[model samples]
Target: MCQRGIKVTHVSKGSSSTKIQRFIPLANGLTDNMKSFAVFLLVLRYLSVSHGCTCMEGPQQFPAVQIDAGQGNVVMTDGNNYAYFLLGSQWYKMGSLNLKHVSVGPAGIWGVDLNNRVYKYVAGSFVFANGESLQQVDAGGDGQVVGVTDTSTIHCLKSTIASDYRKQSTLSWTTITGGLMYFSCSSKYGCWGVNSLQNIYFTRVTPSTCGISGWIQVDGLAVMVEIGTDGSVFVVTRGGEVFQRQGIDSSTPQGTSWTKIPMPSRISHVSYDRGNLWVVTDYGTILKCLY
Candidate 1:
């Protein structure tokens, strides 16, 4: 999903005054003229790398394989498939069940294990959601959840499935037409997905009954796609390029064009929520980006 040979340069945001003061103490063991030149070079190097968006290393960057964020909640899995949930500034390990892919949204925190078993976070543990099996499941949809099986079949949670965790109700899913290798949903503008052919498509999904309209093909090829809660769409192509949907609103759901978002290194997985863009790089680095 990513290439090599590019060294990652970490860029962080700071006050202009603080940046100048940071170099004040580095003038030791140098002539007055040499100190000034060294500081100038450092500042210039910093400015050249800090462009587009500022990104810092995430709290826990232990080779994140998959990450999802929604409603101020962030959940991810390490290379070992151990689940974790971010609380405040610390990441607390969630349950003992190993999960390959996890998601968080209005419906709840749900995941699909290596065995393709579906589980939902209830109370403080993951509980089996009926006997459903899927390769990846997304809970970001409005009042429901959608998932794609290993065979690329799409299914959505039944409307009867309550979002409340305390209910602990037996969840069921209804199959949706169309095959998708990767899919993401938003409460506002429905869902967006990418098929095995790398074709991008969109559909209006009824949150009430998990009903979906016909697929509307977009003019692009993407390996994966993610829909932000605020109706924003972001996609990563097969070449590890990231782009955001431009001019998207209530009227133009498909948007007009794509605006590339600069990244220091190649990224495999990306999740956007609020104003933060979380990405796992090719070399197993998780960066929290602010635009």
Candidate 2:
């Protein structure tokens, strides 16, 4: 079990984009940044007792918490790091075994709210893309496991499993963020997203003539909001706007353009994997973005 302070209250929350960076209040005291939690992309952070991740050792093992996975759905990673629980009320640890969404993360997190309790994890914990885990195979005999499945979010356990990926995703991807659409500059890819309704699409820099032109708007949904980087796309009204984030992926390894792609699966959700994008459509069809 984890440490729990009785009678703890007051969970502080704020927008990191437009104000002074602040640490969230824990059940007992002020949770210092880089002290008790890991912040990536400044979008979301999981609750843990220790702050600052161990790069050389990577993410660690817990003492086993309560998960509760369910029926068929899917989970995945950006092939990088991911967070599982929001960690409020109390912070606990598991026993070495992670309740990963799929086998890994970077794809994105999900939630199962049977009683209306929303949570977060990745896409692969519950299912994977049908491809075997490259991390596990490369690890030789470390006993690492991964998989692929539809991204329907049939359960709540997927997010918990993918949370551990953060340990290994350290070397690559300057930062990781939970998002519907993403682009990268280091890789020279433009963007990865679905429409306002969840349609999916992938596009990139055409410079003179790399063949692909104007951010491609594939079909999709769940592409709620997006900001661009320089030479990137706009976020508002399809006019003069850009999706840029400072202090987070500032080097801009993310998408700059903001065009909603189409989703073959009407009910499908989106996830990012090392700039390699993946999504599940309404028809239970899985899609990937090829640069």
Best by TM-score: 1
Every candidate's CA RMSD: 8.3, 19.6
lDDT of 2: 0.26
Quote the lDDT for 256 in model 1.
88
Tell me the tens digit of each residue's lDDT in model 1 across 82-194.
89999876779998899999999998899999999988888888987765689999988886889999899999885447475344455667889999998999988879999
Q: Which stretches of candidate 1 lie over 4 Å from their true place?
A: 1-52, 162-170
lDDT for predicted candidate 1 compared with the true structure: 0.80
User: What is candidate 2's lDDT per residue for 1-291, written digit by digit as tens?
Assistant: 112211212245644433324433322353443332232212222212122211011122121111111111123222122223313322222122233322222223332222222222333332222212211100000111111112311111122333444332311111112222222221223434333344444443232222233344442233322212222221222321212222223354333333333222232233332322333332222333322
Global lDDT of each candidate: 0.80, 0.26
